[model samples]
Target: MTATAPLPDTAGLRSRFDAELANFLDRQDPDWPDGAPRGVFRTLHRFVLAGGKRLRPLFCYWGWRGAGGADGTPIVVAAAALELFHAFALIHDDIMDGSERRRGEPSVHQLFADLHARSAWRGDAGSYGRNTALLCGDLCAAWSDQMFHECGLSTDEVHQGYRIFSLMRTEVIAGQYLDLVSGVGDGSVASALTVIRMKAARYTVTRPLQIGAALAGAGADLMTALAAFGDPLGDAFQLRDDVLGVFGDPAVTGKSILDDLREGKRTVMMALARDSADRNQALRIKTLFGNPGLDADGAAELREIIVATGALDRIEQMIRVRTEAALAALEQAPVVPEAREVLAALAAEAVDRRL
Candidate 1:
């Protein structure tokens, strides 16, 4: 993440929101009965608080403000609920990717493993840790709902928002399955495009925008415009993420590049490389994936191959094209100036960020 220059004072707006989020998280810490295994609630709380852009909450706020709604504690709670859902996703994602860090600290699984080893928990420490983290992720999912439950949205609005969220999860998981399945079979352009739309594009940008717009009682036409805007912005965001996953500074991204490459993610970059590679190129790529000692030199070679295949150029082209489309949508939308300015800034950051 770049050091953003100081801009407007949002302290008054942010403090109240932070309080609500913190309070909901606190409720997750129901005291354990004596002699029972302790829950990892506090640890999880720390994990969520470590760092994030708070993008969901910010969107919720801006959307509400755009609708001329009063900003208050309840609105803040509703906004914070969106982030809790993200926490649920991240915990599981870390486990799936076998990642060791989050927000520059040891990930939940790793932390549990270390605890097991140091405190001498019964059973295999590593196995125990994995199970604990998995459960913790499940717990986070439940806690997210609890946070949403506390939001003061009308029943109908809350139901609508949740419906969008439910669809969001299904789409994302389907995308994940597509990513996993692509590994076993030959890659196809059609399937790749489907996964891209379902996985990164919809959830990260489009749905969030829709959820907010719908909550604010936006008309169908406005919602349609928001969706169009989100598609390109979301694509740009994901493409930027893919680039960062491979080549970004670890200090900025808070995770090792090695994990993603080793996981053999069926990214657009990888899929394109496969499409363009010759027989010899195919054989080379097949060999290097998932080798534990696929070192820096090997990683660099793989990267070179990906770029040399002209896939990188295509991916870069797609980013530019989609970003332009998103900008055009924004230009056409009847968004107010204050919300428009922030959204514009966010769109630029989504594509142009170093991390």
Candidate 2:
């Protein structure tokens, strides 16, 4: 591979994105009485400004640049809008997955739950937290749409991009629903791959790239080329996430290693394990895989089973293959040289992560 240049001032780009988000939040006035209700927006402000990888916006930004779009406020605002959509996804995902932590802090719902309990509020604290977080997620989604539309792009440009953005939303929701059902249904590798493709692959990479390309008036051919480069990379990204969820340090990943095991997340790795386990191993897996009270010891045993069955090795190989495919496609993609280099670097960072 050719030596890739260092990515553009990513810190600078992140600072600008943060400023846009802050400015947007500052403009929001709930017009409600002061109390916990008003605090909702405050919490949202903190959540929005909180730390994130900002991968979607970076991808979108580069996508715009690759398609001959200039570096300007319009693209930055439009790209940053993706972060709001990402926040919306994460808040709701944490709620659905019953996750308590995010970015090394209490999840949006858990933050609200803790507040309710601390204040000795009436009713169920858990319910209140989930409800409030749902509203927050909804607000983020709405704000994402508003920001994208008001991103100072031409009317035609905004209109062109909205179609892809709208479709991306629908696809992600559908993917989430599929994930919900797949957990309870037969846990097949095919089912897991479907979930990954819909939930992570397209949503995380393909659509974001396409949306930026569309905003820059890219044609069908370039759109197809971006998908070719994005889809495999996105798959590898999710596969790495599944590995981290099971084997990563909580301190580094900002998530409990046992959560996926406890939640019975039917990942491709787990499916592979189940498929290859011996009878005794299968019995052990069936007994302990989804137990909500699973402790560290049980998690260790599950990890052993996964390793013994070669699931971890298989997943590692899959990630490697998909990443290679993505890079190869990117090399052949009809994009500018700067985008090609930055995107190659981004792909490596996205999949080759300890966190």
Candidate 3:
């Protein structure tokens, strides 16, 4: 008799998680009338399967493993649900930011807009595109909940997962609102950091870990340790993302260099630059930072300003410090051996990645 090979830790889990999504999408109910908008499902399938780091799911899976949950399919299914929720977030985020591209292709709204234009359908192509994408996002959110509820955990386990799930969804939406509100008034470093904590820190790492830990029925001590590790790592991750948004190669990052500056994202990097700029440099920034017509020259000038003010160096140092703190917390936590190693590696990647 031949023996089956053991699954390779997280990589195997990711592949299986992706396969679950594909299988679910492929098996959708065809009994629905032909009048049903099947194209929306198709579009969502492509969007969810397309390029992403799958960071949230990875954190979730590791969190489950770290909490002494036995290797099985249930945890993986739960983790994949986070990806669906993330799809909802990204779809709406692109529309909100008016982003043209994501993962090196037209964003969901942009894709719909292009389709409308090419097909010569409807009254207003842009509005149609936006509305269609909004529906798609809402569908993803609904699907996330559906997937979570159907994962076949025990009733108590499901209830636990739901608590984390509900709280996470609420926090991210509230964080996004905070982000939008910050754009209108004062663009201080403190406000930007607050946005980072709510939007990126908790949603990206902390709550996902907590959700997985909840699935395993982890104790308060373990949850606290995970939060201590996740908070700093997530903060560094968002800070690195801000840096990449402005300074990274478009080919490498698959995002426009000018989008954040154009949208006036009010990021920590920008806040630090504003804090340190001289009078004329400050005026130049005030004039060009949020200008819709900010061209390459303007972007280059902004980049130079950020660099000259030492904000980039300061932020880099902050990333290093936060990464060290996360690693330290991970070292002290009583997590399983393999999970500890994987999470430690992920911490470094989260703070120091190029894309």
Each prediction's TM-score versus the true structure:
0.89, 0.96, 0.96
> Residue 22 of model 2: what lDDT?
88
RMSD, each candidate, Å?
4.4, 3.1, 2.9
Candidate 3 structure quality by residue, lDDT tens digits, 180-288: 9999968999999999998888888888888888888888999999999999989989999999999999998888999999998999999999999999999999999
lDDT per prediction? 0.74, 0.91, 0.86
- How well is each residue in 234-339 modelled by candidate 1, as lDDT tens digits? 8778887887788788999897887777877667778888889988788878877566667888778778888889988988898999999998888887656566
Q: Which portions of model 2 miss their true places by more than 4 Å? A: 1-7, 29-36
Ranked candidates (lDDT, high to low): 2, 3, 1
> Pairs clashing in candidate 3?
none
Evaluate residue 335 in candidate 2 and report its C-alpha lDDT on the 0 to 100 scale.
88
Clashing pairs in 1: none
Stronger candidate by TM-score (1 vs 3): 3
* Root-mean-square deviation of candidate 1: 4.4
Clashes of each: 0, 0, 0
